[model samples]
Target: MNLVKLSELLEVSRSAVTQSVRRLIKKDLVSFEFAQDNEKKYI
Candidate 1:
């Protein structure tokens, strides 16, 4: 999910989601990609 949507869904601040996503990416625990529609998708 996008940062803003994720933050809203998780009821957290955007910065918090940003930090957690950064960590997850660094650890390779989560991944994201742009679909054919050019929208971000998480996997």
Candidate 2:
């Protein structure tokens, strides 16, 4: 989910979601990719 949607879903702040996502990325539990149009998708 996008940051805004994720924050709302988790009832957390945007920064918190950002931090958590960063950690998950570092841990290789999640990954992100940017499309040719510059849209980000998480996998």
Candidate 3:
């Protein structure tokens, strides 16, 4: 899901979701990609 959706579902701020994603990325646990259909990034 995208950051916005994730934040909404988790009831957290987008910044919080971003920080978590960054940590996961550092550990190679998750990665994000740009959607060709839109400018949004997905995890």
Name the top lDDT candidate. Answer: 3
RMSD of each: 2.0, 2.2, 0.6
Q: What value of lDDT does candidate 3 attain over all alpha carbons? A: 0.96
Error of 1 at 11 (Å): 0.6
Better of 2 and 3 by lDDT: 3
lDDT digits (tens) for residues 1-43 of candidate 1? 6777899999999899988998999999988776676676544
Q: Which residue segments of model 2 deviate by more than 4 Å?
A: 35-43
Better of 1 and 3 by TM-score: 3
Q: Which candidate is the best by TM-score?
A: 3
The TM-score of candidate 1 is 0.69
Score every model by TM-score.
0.69, 0.73, 0.92
lDDT (10s digit) by residue, model 3, range 1-43? 8899999999999999999999999999999999999989999
Clashes of 2: 0
Q: After superposition, how far is residue 35 of candidate 2 from its true place, in Å?
A: 5.9
lDDT of model 1, residue 18: 83
Clash number for each model: 0, 0, 0
Stretches of candidate 1 above 4 Å error? 35-43
Residue pairs with backbone overlap in model 1:
none
